[model samples]
Target chain A: MSNASTRNRGIPNPLAWIGAAALGLFGEIGRLAVFSARVKAAAFSPRWYIGQIWKQIVQIGFFSLPVVGMSAIFIGAALALNIYQGSGRFGAEQFVPNIVVLGITRELGATITALMLAGRVSAGISAEIGAMRVTEQIDALESLSASPYRYLYAPRFLAALIALPLLVLVADIIGVMGGWAVSVFGLGFDSTVYLRNTLDFVTRNDILTGLIKAVVFGAVIALMGCYQGDRSKAGATGVGRAATLSMVGAAVLVLASNYIMSTIFVEVGL
Target chain B: MTTPILSLQNVEKRFGKNHVLRGVTLDVAPGESLVVIGGSGSGKSVMLKNALGLMTPDSGKILFNGEDVTQAKGKTRARMRERVGMLFQSGALFDSLTVWENVAFRLVNSGVVSRAKAKDRAIETLSKVRLGSDVADLYPAEISGGMQKRVSLARSIISKPDLIFFDEPTTGLDPITADAINDLIIEQVRGLGAATVTITHDMASARKIADEVAMLFEGEIIWRGKASDVDNSGNPYVDQFVHGRAEGPIQPAL
Candidate 1:
């Protein structure tokens, strides 16, 4: 009996372990909420860093153009091929332009562009801020009477907010053109017909909804990167962990928010 | 008696179960330089951070000029910080900015001066730290470690703050560089007449710069006295720490 009792003492209770994990999850959620509120407050307040915001806009939007454009074109091409193959079974291959335009505008353009940024911009922001945190630059800013939220975070937040929608618009145009390329050139379809079908099939609401989603995804990306970076621990390992967490968190939040927003839009007949 | 420019009354801080600071109390008068010496992880940096309002203490009253600014926020905290400067360990210069930009960061960011004037002031401050105007345009990463520290020093004193904190100012440099830094620190603090708190384990640094020397052990100030008395404090802990003895009451961590 004593030997059995000693063995039991070494084992953790499953219920207790689960309870602790649940509490930790809730704690993290609460902290993220507080961080979001703080970012909003900072954005609305005075002492705005306009120069920094402009610089971030150039960094986040201009520099991201090549990658986002590349991804859109490739995804658009592959999407056209797949849709052509899938719809051919029903003897409906002519519907490829309509479906491609619909998918790109209503869902794929914003989502894919956001995911690409989640990999590139989110990781970059987190690593840069995490390095600052570790090296005491954030603390130095505080010492200088400069608010980190105002100087560092609000600029990035506002820049991403302003940049993402514009980027998605470009991505939508390129994506539709990509599908046009694959369908007309590869599948021997008429070019003018494909372009006309795309334009006629897509609606103002479809494009607007994608832009709206881009705004939210942009906020999510910036928030995750800043939050993770600010909370990072000491040293290189801590910085690396922060970057990883920011990318993962941004991607997950973007998808989740996209689903919720899409469901709402559908309910409202958008 | 003049009120202490900075005072920590019964400051306590903890990280989870580890009680990093257990009621640490200290004071620094205006125009005074107080050097705190302690082994690594003795809560020396934590105590300094609490005093600077960077880290809040679990329980304590931090009075700046006899005003309790322990829980100060917003403009009050910003106002408090404006009158203070810090030289961080590893220099902590903004990697993206040139040396002059880093030095003049506060002035330009606060809208206190034009960019041209700020650049001139930054170059002037850099000269005071023995750095030439040519070094002003270089990035922090471009400079040597010792030069980085000097630039950091210049940045700290640019505002001519009422109070300053130096965290491990001489930790990574060679002995010659370290001594030069200590001398510069003394000269600057005297020139500004600022009340300063510096935390370092270097006995030589403490002796050279300290008006009063305090020893923190296990998150408490076990002994404090004049800089001259640090060598013969009659306390075994100070004695052991001063001479660097292995077999003292203070055990080395495994």
Candidate 2:
């Protein structure tokens, strides 16, 4: 066949794939539009939005506390044990308290814990929203003139943004407590000394940096969750893909962003 | 004739190698009811999608209110949509919302009424469809298929749209409920003076609600005439489809 006829006769390979991707993306954007329209059309006054916010606070913040706390405690204990063993070989056993404080507060506590939370929250958000989209509820909203984004995504995003930091803060505190427990009990260090050292080792900058990471991680998780879920296609299979992608993608991205943010923070001398 | 509320001029749409719509042209004048009758996969759904701007046509002019609406975008598209309503094949009511909320959706989106007022309007619309106000609080899943269809209908007409499209509106309902819905559709269209275009395989519905009927076969309208002429169109394809015959001009799918 001539090249012109070849081109005219069938779907272009690259164009077909591009068109498929575009259709998927457009479906998501359409969903977002429908979500926003539904909210606008719902006459959900300021009171309704506020109520939604409150609901988010409970769902995102309160419900996440136990997991964040447990994960942080276990991580802190494991780090302390590892540091104590390494320091002992160097005849630097006394350095265990300082290393525990520095490691848990400076990097591991917020970064690792936030990564876990991102996987949990993002996967949940994506699955819930993806299922809703797959089932035609989103279309119903559009037919009714409601915007799905404002109705569905906005409140969830806000909840994650607000609740995640609080969860991280709890995790940070519990993590320090875990480190203290190990330093005092396993290492046979004086409780008072370990407490003083932890207090002295932790700078205001360390806490602030962790909180900032928490906030950034929260936004990333929410964005990925909403994007993947809202854009899902092909029913259950699509929803399953959305949930998996949201979790795995959020976990990887959160860790990667933590490293980048940490580098920027150190370079800026903050 | 009063200006056609909707007009499709040589509209065409194709999906990959499959041509769904082949230079289809039709019109719905003000307050008129036009039904496009065809078998499954005959491009009836695609035609409605094209008119609704859900699917972009490869070529054609769709004039709404005498203005080219084929490629209207942003605010213009939104405004055009605000005056139009659609009933999807599956009722497609939001499972998360109550019946009243679904019915009140367009009214709320118009940003012209308070929530209290919108709810009241929704309830009134529901009542018009013979659904009690008590049904308004029920989720879509809580209702029977017929009731859900009624709620869907209520949602469609609540906006009092100038143009409406019904996709297989009576498809899943039993004979009695389907007839009731068809009558309600006719009553509402007449009452609101809104132009309507319905696509269906149901000849009885076409006869009841259509002022004019067009038969779509193999991506083209093979017959077009007044509703009364459907049975006597003398077109083999139309006869086959209307009678649900197995063997005719439309070969069975292999």
Candidate 3:
């Protein structure tokens, strides 16, 4: 009550709030850059922790296959139905198989697989690492004279970077089959004819472009996870916040990078 | 003069506006047991961390034997850390690694021993801590808190370093278990002939494991002497802390 007479009664100071937000964002970006540099330096050092990398590959790559396959299959089925309906209006329903294969191979398969992994792998990494951080296991590593970045992060990053492209390749094949199933069973097209149409329409460049997108998205997902967890504050609440931020950040970065990469692919005529 | 095994010279550290450590200076002679006793948030951990080179001091130097290792970087830091082990307050055992793997971490991680030999050594170390063969293959999460603490102790002493830091080794255990842990720690340190620095709020633990004790209060070492003299030291803050007083020079943080 004493301070009420001295305070401004009108609107909030938008510029001050906006400026503070901008500064905070810049600080975060700067921290991430330094962390990435340390990762690069650690990469050049000996003792790469290949055992840890293998464990992570099995965890992130092999275990994620079923979920990725399921999503790709559903995406293919949904795309076939949508494309068939739209093409039907133009009396070009015959192009359904061709378009479905082309769509999955060129973009949808890779982007969807990456986004799925951003939720699964990235969030898992942040939570695990953040918990280690708060509990001082990371400090324990330092006490043991080991680099936490090398022992903890490098392996996960390498696994995600390797796993995404492989997963994307798997997604492409499964997605095409899914579209074929929908075309044959749901749309009443002949199975052999639909398969032939997909094969004929799909190109090497389309498959490679999707794989490339997957690799970039993979790095973004793992890097953001490691970054958030590395700088995590104290307590259970802090770990939870780190995991949430890592997942959201990874998903957003994946989507944004997907758009940019797709545009680059188109511009380059790939 | 033979240099002390560890030395902190006027070291200071601040986090944001909070000065956790202020001009801390201390030394541990070879094979000596020095326990730091402080209330929660009294900068005891920060002092130990600075000495271990886990956290750099805002000012002054940390000398290990003779060389300054405040930065804890490169070959010198590595060589220094080779003879150092820290038992964290929370047991801080890597959850992903099994008990044997956790104990043998330093050896396997640094390639000092083959994986096959490390497992055998881990089991041997576990036995020293009075844990049975059944405990080795279990994950940290699969064990009780007491078991986890024992495992952590085993890990710390597995490498048999010359200088060790034990952070609250008996914090959560019951009286019997706490005594058991203190006994285990004593056995390990004596067997290694190591200089020890332990931080705890437990007077019983300090009395049991320490040859000398230091009290961290208001970001400084306010009182220190022979462990036997702690009860009669007479400093109000140390008196309040040692007796677990509700009202004294040391106010509740809230």
Please, what is the TM-score per model? Answer: 0.98, 0.83, 0.96
The local distance difference test score of model 2 is 0.82
Query: What lDDT does candidate 3 reach at residue B87?
Result: 95
Question: Tens digit of lDDT per residue, candidate 3, span A1-270?
Answer: 556655644556789889999999999889888997787577557779999889999999999999999999999999999999999998999999989988999889998998899889888899888989989999999888888889888888888888999999999988888888888998999988898888888889989999999889888888888888887889988988998999999999999998999999999999
Error of 2 at A229 (Å): 2.6
Complex DockQ, candidate 1: 0.89
Location of the lowest summed lDDT over 10 successive residues in candidate 3 chain A: A2-11
Ranking by DockQ: 1, 3, 2
Please report the candidate that would top TM-score against the real structure.
Answer: 1
Model 3 interface CAPRI class: high
Better of 1 and 2 by DockQ: 1
Please provide, for model 1 over A1-270, each residue's C-alpha lDDT reduced to its tens digit, 9 standing for 90 to 100.
699899888998899999999999999999999998999899888879999999999989999999999999998999999999999999999999999988998899999999999988988999999999999999999988888999999999999999999999999999989999999999999999998888888999999999999999999999999999999989999999999999999999999999999999999999
What are the per-residue Cα lDDT tens digits for candidate 2 across A1-270? 799888776766788789999999798668655654543344334423555667767877788788888989988888888888888887987777677767776677777777777767888889878877776567656545455666676677667767777777788778878877887887798989888878887888887888888877887787778778887886778999999988887898888998999999999987
lDDT of each: 0.94, 0.82, 0.90
TM-score of chain B of 2: 0.97
Per-candidate DockQ versus the true complex? 0.89, 0.37, 0.88
- For DockQ, the strongest prediction is 1
Writing each residue's lDDT as its tens digit, candidate 3 over B80-139 gives 988998899999999989999999999998897999999999999999999998988999
